[model samples]
Target chain A: MEKILPIGEYIEKGINSLEQNLSFLWSAIDDGISWLVENMNDLFLAIPFVIILALIAFIAYYVKAGNKMFTLSGLKKAYGLTIFVILGLLLIYAMGYWEEAIQTTTLVIVSTIIALILGIPFGIWSAKSNTADTVIRPILDFMQTMPAFVYLIPAIFFFSVGNTPGVIATVIFSLPPSVRLTNLGIRNVPGDVIEAGRAFGANENQILYKIQLPLAMPTILAGINQVILLALSMVVIASMVGAKGLGSIVYQGIQQNDIAKGFESGLGIVVLAMILDRITQSIGSKK
Target chain B: MADDNNIRIKVEDLTLIFGKRKKEALELLNQGYSKTDILKKTKCTVGVNKASFEIKKGEIFVIMGLSGSGKSTLIRCLNRLNDPTDGRVYFKEHDITRDSNKQLLDTRRTEMSMVFQKFGLLPHRTILENAAFGLEIRGEPKEQRDEKGMKALKTVGLEGYEDQYPAELSGGMQQRVGLARALANDTDVLLMDEAFSALDPLIKSDMQDELLQIQNKLHKTIVFITHDLDEAMKVGDRIAIMKDGVVEQIGTAEEILTDPATEYVEAFVEKVDRKTIITAETLMFDNPIIVRFKKDGPKAAIRKMREAGVNVLPVEDNDEKFLGYVWLEDMLKLEKEKAKTVESALNTEVPSVYKHYTVEEMLPLITGHHHPLAVVDDEGKLEGIITQTSLIIESTRFDDKEMDKLIGEANEL
Candidate 1:
């Protein structure tokens, strides 16, 4: 209020100069992200509806197999999960939002993959080094606490409004929980257990993968579950940047006062969330 | 029984300081500063001092002490789990302390394996997978490693529980899986850091006996760490007693029990019941007076007993065969009856014990003996005699000065 520093103007000038100076690097990143999102979207849409449903059933059945013994009760839960997956898909199709559902699912998945690729290594680095942890922790805190709407402004400037920019914003918003949870999981591994690995002559790499990662897996899977939920929650907000999907349909509903349209697409998103949540939560709880 | 020439592991002046300023602490430690004094000055914890000892091949060398004495740190350093700040460790002839990553990896894979106090089994892994972990890390084929792991599981008496996760098993059974992991590695040296300490006492003892049974067949060089003196005494061929990051004494269990080198060691030895430490070998007097069998008849037996100033003499045949004891009264009576051989005069009722028997086992026999209880070898040849006086002397062999000091300290306590 006193205008002691004029921090906002200073940040604006700094960002302006950064944009001009690093335009080439930004373009390269923008192109790479565009290619990845386009191909992933195509891959998600190209699969037949029947194949997608069967694939979901396969994944659900496989994951459920780990949770149960050879008893009838166990098979009942497994079959229940598979049937639930089929019902959810049919509900989306019957609502006539099946294609939009696929696009939104692809968007959520692509953003999550990119976020994970970046987050997991960063998490491992933070877990391993005090310096990295000190630096990453505050950045993670800032990313998590910032208003989700604030991401779209920077997203538009970086890649201009589209599904690509929308995904970029979603990844940034979803990244922290993945990194934080992964770090916590690795850090929480018992010191004696790691020492036991070392005593048996496991190399640093072997220890990381064979001992640490496997032990840290359940916690990491929990992180992935959070990432999926966060990515899905970003869908409508992303649609505000002209990303096409069920979020755009919801956005159209909000604009023209079409209650039925908003409710249908919102229901479609809910169906997706429930299905994804159940599968990912199952993976985490199986251990 | 440990041979000096067949050393398996030689640890020399090994030291570990835990803190950011370890270099300064180690320097101060070398300059005659105590661990506490150095800690005060540099804020570094001395995990292991300038500790040193050798382990013989096929021997169970135990590092034993109270908590915070650095026994665990010392054992961990042997395998570089807790890296030493100074000194060298040799497995056979290779200096493991300075081994490169590849060399260290090779050494750990092929030459040594470790078992941990808390089991350290992977919770997600089945018992079989946990048992094969060491070999798996070394990149052995699954089939071969699994076969070896199964054998090790059988050896530890956990053969049928292979598919169960470690958490599903009882703690003792889980520890058996841990042991199976080490044994499956098939390495010559085993570093066990308080391996059986977490088990219930009965299971702990059972595991201890099981370890010895496995040791008998495998004869691997084992370095066991424990704070429990009974466990140490029961398993160790030789023990290094540690106190405050320094090794106070290293000796056989008997030597540590009978001749503790420091006051700290004496304090620990004080708690030990003497019967467990003093064996028949310790109590027996070697080469007691005896009458020669074929050459010495009942007449000569009586003369030998009289001259030796004993009521009884152990009679041995020419080949050192134990022919029982000949009592002076019996020999005299037999001589009067014109008995020609010492065999005729020998009582043949003398109770005998093997040299390996503990003094506790010979207490009843020695209490009412007419003569010292004969200590015989497995061949039944008399090796020595355990007199009641000798048993008492050996059992209460503590120095009077030390006992007085201990009593004075106890009063203070």
Candidate 2:
């Protein structure tokens, strides 16, 4: 009522001090991420698009058909996924935004990988210790539910504009599912089985590696699927803060009131997202 | 305590109280409070109360009680799966209670292993891999562990199931994998806590029999826990009956049934099939009336039968070898004819039983026989005689007073 809370000023003061003291640290992170994103995009573009198509198609086909390559039923089952992948990749390549799509793909891949590396361990810690779980749960909730746009501010302050901030924001938005689901998976493992492990003199590390992690694989895989999808969704929002790729194309198209450009570039993003999503989801679901 | 050298595991005054107020509960227990009273006052359940016993090597020491009895907790203490609130457990000469984590792990991996009630096999793992879990944890090489695991699987009659997942097996088969897992560790002690309680009666019986057969060959010191009195009788060399977390009595199944130490124990054995537990050696009469077939005449046999008030006298050679029986009526007729030895009047068709033959087994032999059945040792030496009346009386009453008198008479053993 009387401006008793000056929460925004307090945050601004903190941010100013952090930026003044940590500029060196921020630039280093910024340079490292930018280098990573550029190289990864260049690598994606350098690979023959046809080989990439073939790889995706091959993976999609095998997801449907297992080791039985020559079997008629397996072939019949494989054709659907293979054709879908091929068509999807061909459409994205034919679109004039192939390079931008590849750039977006690189950002998504890099962001998802980083998110998982941090999220999985956090999840495992939360699952194992009640105190860690209590402390982490609210933080994870904040990361997931705080507006994706709000994240760009701090992400930019920390790493500056470009793919680094975009990747940072994407990681923040997508990280919660991995942490939450990994914790769920490990916690859901039957207690008696764990008791059995302890009964047999299985040490802490042995129990985690042999019993907990293996049993939790499918659920962790599902969490990874969610992370990838969330990172892809952040592509357009990331474009608002000077991120590259399909998101930037769509952003310009909207500014210019060019409906055709916007929808076409947006379609390219959909095609890419669909291919990656189907592949990852199938991996988790595979027997 | 019987022989120090052969004691595999000795638990001394072990108490396990389960709750936050363990110290208070223990104090109340020490002050002679009842278990329920302790629980009411401190909100602590006494899992085991000053349970003390010695498990002999190569014998099945069963801890038996109903659900909520401290049997499961007591067994867990042997492996330190559940640490005691008080007292100590000794393995060989070492105090297991004082063992460091490394020593306890070594004990679990090399000296003792446990089987669980729920079959605790990993559903994701093959039967062989689950069986080899203990070995793998203890740092056995993959090849050696697999070989031992496979061998252990065969021992538990799960050879063909080695590659299959636990979900593929029935409950009983899953439990065999559990057994094989412990067996693969090659430990001397096997602590089974309600290991077969989850199985149906028929499968449970098969597992029990198989356990006994395996025990016969391996001779591992097994501490088995069961809610079933019958199973305790079937598997145990000696049993400790528990109630309200206190050990009621520890003795052989026969001793518990024939001479229960507490009312709670008596309640548990009330419906138990007595014939399966009462053997000829326990029910037979020692120093029975007998006619010497080598030198005694029919008149001597008649007089012996008359004095003993028996319809027949068992005929034994001078060597005390069981020959047969002679009917008192036949001996009288033969005596009137002045027959020399009782051998002519001997009824060699009488049924006989070994000393260890159970009353259930003796029932079929005793139905129509007028003469008593000879209870003999392996060498056919007459140890005692079991009459149908003694068999029926002892089997029906299921008490020790009659057997006590007979045992008192035969204190020579």
- Regions of candidate 1 where Cα sits further than 4 Å from its true position: A21-58, A65-71, A79-87, B1-5, B291-311, B316-322, B326-346, B364-369, B378-381, B392-413
- What is each predicted model's overall lDDT from 0 to 1? 0.87, 0.89
Q: How well is candidate 1 docked (DockQ)?
A: 0.75
Best by DockQ: 1
Q: Give the per-residue Cα lDDT of candidate 2 at A44.
A: 86
List of chain B TM-scores, one per candidate:
0.87, 0.93
Candidate 1 residue-wise lDDT, B247-364, digit = tens: 9999999999878898889988887877877888876779888888888888787777778787888888888988788778888888889988867666677789998888778777
Candidate 2 C-alpha lDDT tens digits along B1-413: 45798999999999999999999999999999998899899999999999999999999999999888888888989989899999999999999999999898888888988899988888889999999999999999999999999999999998887888899899999999999999999999998989999999999999999999999899999999999889999999999999988899999989998899988888889899988988887888898877888888987777777789878778888788888988878888898888798767788988889978998888888776577789988888888898766787766773468776766777866
Minimal lDDT window, size 10, model 2 chain B:
B398-407
TM-score of candidate 1 on Cα atoms, chains taken together: 0.88
Report the TM-score of the second chain of model 2 against its true counterpart: 0.93
**Shift in Å, residue B196, candidate 1:** 1.0
In candidate 1 the C-alpha lDDT for residue B14 amounts to: 96
Whole-model alpha-carbon lDDT for candidate 2: 0.89
